[model samples]
Target: MDYATYIAGLPRVLAGAGVIFRDAEDRILLVEPNYRRDGKWILPGGTVESDEGETPRQAARREAAEEIGLDVALGPLLAVDWVPGTGRPPLVSYLYDGGVLDEAQLAAIRLQEAELTAWRLVAQDEAGSYLAADMQRRIRAALGALAAGRGAAELEDGYGPADLRAR
Candidate 1:
């Protein structure tokens, strides 16, 4: 079978999420999957379904609700990525800027057992160690874009519109 055929048999359309929450000192939110396949820690994200007729922002908000049981205020598009040779099909991820109501809400988080086991609020410097190299770059770039009053937009080499999960 060709690559397209192989990917078609895999799971749902791959998507992305912007892990956002507040710490005691007003930091960002992040999550760690319960299991590690590639021995890497990834940000919170999942599939983007075409049937949902949703934009990337809608997909991010949906993932936040389903994965963490929380409603998120979706912000600008943060970053885009493509994961290659990762067992599953090549994935196109659309990251967004997500925020919660307040820091107090971080305490009441309820994780979706089937997806994530727990969540954490980490400081900016601490993020690089816990997250994968690619994620670390994206997060840092997104933060930088937000700080500079610009939206983050980076397309990994070899990734194109055809890679989008919505397709």
Candidate 2:
């Protein structure tokens, strides 16, 4: 097969990266996107530009800076979610730890005017009201991982139990 044909036949998937930013009170930061007609509140993130040679972690940090105007050293990986697609390729989402921001860092948040209309720090219990069901699940799992000091988690469609071991 020709190089073009081989490349064309290769599988393709879209990738996205987001940061889970929290405040001193442990509320998650949620952004209301202006570009979405459905008005889904989401974490600060966007699609990874493959052409830019950016890794998922880099993309997450860049998105945080671009969307929230906060330059922070991102913590470890929190969760990776593989979302099934409708008509297109599936989406692989990476969620990173933005770490708990102090009062000073929280005071400096500035939403990107072009993409976000508002931002709020919502408690964990109230995240479901602001986020989609799948996203809420992902965030909850990530929070659990954070509290336990465990490594990154793998999720399918935002659900856990990545592996089952015999008793």
Candidate 3:
């Protein structure tokens, strides 16, 4: 096929990037989105604007600023999850470390009311109750990756790099 035809025939996939911000106590930051009625909380992030020539890292920074009103320099990438379709195209998500937030920074938060209803810092163990299964996995993997002092962890459907019952 010709270049244009080949490009047009390529499978479509969605991409997102997020920043994992933590409190001084090391609690993970989670946001309640106004869009989801299911009540699942998520990290600060959104769809990558590829059409606007935005990269994953740039998207993460932009989303963080938009959602939580903080402009921060991100740390190393923590995790990447590949999620299959539930009712739409597949998705690939990138997670980066936003580092710790000080008291002043925490107090300065201004939620993007159009998208977020509230935000909280939840303990690592408490993340499960607020997040989706896939999200829990991604967060665990990201934290594990950070703790292990390694590079990013790869996940499939937010499950595992596990060919087995894995971490």
Candidate 4:
């Protein structure tokens, strides 16, 4: 096959990035996306513009800024998940640590009216009630990685097994 044909024949998947922010009280910040009718919440992030040469970190920063008016130095990555879509292609999701948001940072939040309707800090345990099952698992993996002080947790379908979480 020609080089172009070979490249086109390769497997493809979508890429996205998100930031996991925390409150001083250790509550995780979740955002309500307007696109979902089920009232499910998610972390602040969007698709990675890889075609435009955007890295996951840059995508996280950009999404944070666009979704919540946030502009702070992000901490290390907490999780990297391979999420299989229901009908669409699979997604390679990067979850970065946004660290703890101080009062000043919290006060500066300006939700993107078109995309988000609200944002709130929810306790880790309470997060499952507001987030989708996969998201809840992703959050758990992310937090576990953060607490472990290890590098990013690797997940498959949002479940990061014990062995894969610390790498």
The lDDT, on a scale of 0 to 1, for candidate 2 is: 0.90
Model 2 C-alpha lDDT per residue in residues 1-72, reported as the tens digit of each score: 999999999999999999999988999999999887766799999999877899998999999999999988
What clash count does candidate 2 reach?
Answer: 0
Give the Cα-based TM-score of candidate 1 against the true structure. Answer: 0.74
For residues 8-111, write the lDDT of model 4, one tens digit per residue. 99989999999999999999999999999899999999999999999999999999999999977889999999998888999999999999999999999999
- Residue by residue across 57-157, what tens digits does model 3's lDDT show? 99999999999999999999999988889789999999999999999999999999999999999999989999998899899999999999999999887
Candidate that would win on TM-score: 3
Candidate 2, after superposition: displacement of residue 157 in Å?
0.8
Arranged by TM-score with the best first, the candidates are 3, 4, 2, 1
Candidate 3 runs further than 4 Å off = 163-167
lDDT of 1 by residue, 86-134 (tens): 6665666777777544645665567888767667777888877777776
lDDT winner:
3
> In candidate 1, how many Å is residue 22 off?
4.1
TM-score: the better of candidates 1 and 2: 2
CA lDDT of each candidate? 0.66, 0.90, 0.93, 0.92
Error of 3 at 103 (Å): 0.6
- For every model shown, the clashing-pair count is 1, 0, 0, 0
How high is each candidate's TM-score?
Answer: 0.74, 0.93, 0.95, 0.94
